[model samples]
Target: MHAKFEIFAAVAPGLELALRDEALERGFRKAKAAPGGVRFRGTWADVWRANLELRGASKVLARIGQFRVTHLAQLDKLARDFDWTRVMRPDVPVRVEVTCKRSKIYHEGAAAERIERALAEELGAPIDPDAQVVVKARIEDDTCTLSVDTSGELLHKRGHKVAVGKAPMRENMAALFLRQCGFDGQEPVLDPMCGSGTFVIEAAEMAMGLQAGRSRGFAFEQLATFDSNAFDALKSPAEPADLAWNFYGSDRNAGAIEMSAANADRASVGAVTHFRHCGTSEAERPQGPSGLVIVNPPYGGRIGDKKALYALYDALGRTLKQRFKGWRVGIITNEASLAKATGLRFKPTSAPVAHGGIKVTLYQTDAIT
Candidate 1:
């Protein structure tokens, strides 16, 4: 309710720092990067704002309460006694997910059952397996920490992207990758092999000062502490900022081009985003100042044969080298040799980031001469 609580913004393992920077820039108090997320302290209003505005977070969790319990009876009693009414509405349906790590109460199912029973009997809340409002319980080292998933759906599902090509990049990851490439939304961004226009649309939205969660709903709205009027105030319409640059995306597949355009339109960034059907070798620099060129090309792990991809990478490299003067490049792939095939002078690869199932890295280059 009125009291401040610890908020955790979950992100991909390699992108915690970028999310932390975003949280701090958004004025979250004491935002710090942990292993897989960024943690900060804020009130319920801040929780609403976080679910509404953060671009890099996969989910925003509000840590409601925590206590030490070594046995199932203790867990049941404590869960029943905890002030669930302070946070959860008795009429709302809720689901519980529990994970036990090196704890005396190690049965996750049993632990979840106990908590669900407590909520049903004591709090008078219905337990639905498919409920959007989740109560995540993590029991580790004899301590149980209960947190509510304030962001119902993953933040990456911004609700606009309906069509996608194979091995599409997620929006949250794309936003963080843009940030890692030093994009502050001032200059143009071009994704030469843009699968679904994720990077391009995200850039356009950021340039126009669009909130990432504008088109979506959140689980926090169902909480008892949620103030509809206050949350509506936080949803104040974002005035589009005038921009001097446009975002561009191109792909060899015509379907990909169509998908990108439709997604851009759905995101309300069609005015500033351009999608065209073209192979990587045919990708040209847009008619503007030199800016960032980021691509998520096919690798052996996800798509295409490794042997044939060499020529594709080489052609991509030659095209950029000959045509994109003064523009920086970022290539994300699971293979170092494929990135090397580009023949660009890369600075260094970033930490391995989990994409789908493969571990991919972002290989960056300085501005081409």
Candidate 2:
């Protein structure tokens, strides 16, 4: 059997463009973009790089096999046909996640049962959902595609920043949003709404040459062909920096400020970011050339109280136009109406990125134009 491998990097709906761009930069090519992911061809080493390098993906899946199956019997045959001995070992427990869409065999439960049985009987193994070795099954348009999840506990977990504010942004989405905002670590960066300081912490880490996946282990370690010595050699200690956190963030909520500061401190970026209890009305623009400003405020999707949120957006817009000069601005919001409240003339540059179960558009303005 060939070791042909592909990758599925989970992304927000609109953030696929950014993820695709990232994939291309990392030598991954022609990824098929979907609502929540991007699929591309790669190797086990490429999979390792995708997990360690992709800032926008929530997780990475390695495609193992795929075949056409119109019925349960066919699926059974296909499952039995795979080189289970080559892929799955008897000692390792495997979990199967099946998603069926537009297929003749629509019984998802039965499909799971069939795959589970095949793994146990044909492959001689146990089934466990939360185990390290995961096999995901998707039956779409009568095609059965099987993928092994090489990433464990989702790449977004990042294994850092235990401190979080109310309605904190996920790390993967935050990284994608920052990239869409055009942050490249050379300019001053600001996150005025700075809940738990996710954006600021991520930005600081980015600026300091830190890998988002540095702290976690991967499911590949459980694979039969995984190279432990190579990955071990790639591991390096987090470098200590004496540089002050050039990134700045402020929030009207003192509790949020406290939590964000703590998160930054834990992420070893406290020295790279400055936190304060200030709203957009009093938020000071970052010192230096026109830099990027990102804000993830309550957009009525994750946080309740829509009436108050509209007013908040209006205030944010006025604050930017009146206070921030020669500085670009980016806002994360679920709906267009809320973005319009900013009153800045902007064309949507990035597609809708998903956040908190809602697709959010990243709005941008060129230095208050």
Best by lDDT: 1
> Cα deviation in Å at residue 241, candidate 2?
5.0
lDDT of 1 at 4: 86
Candidate 1 achieves a global lDDT of: 0.92
TM-score of 1: 0.98
RMSD of each: 1.0, 2.4
Candidates' TM-scores? Answer: 0.98, 0.91
Clashing pairs in 2: 14-352, 245-271, 245-272, 245-273
What's the distance in Å from true for residue 368, model 1?
0.7
Runs off by more than 4 Å, candidate 1: none
Report the lDDT of model 1 for residue 348: 68
Pairs in clash, predicted candidate 1 = none
Instruction: State the displacement of the C-alpha of residue 288, model 2, in Å, after optimal TM-score superposition.
Output: 2.7
Number of the top-ranking candidate, with TM-score as the measure: 1
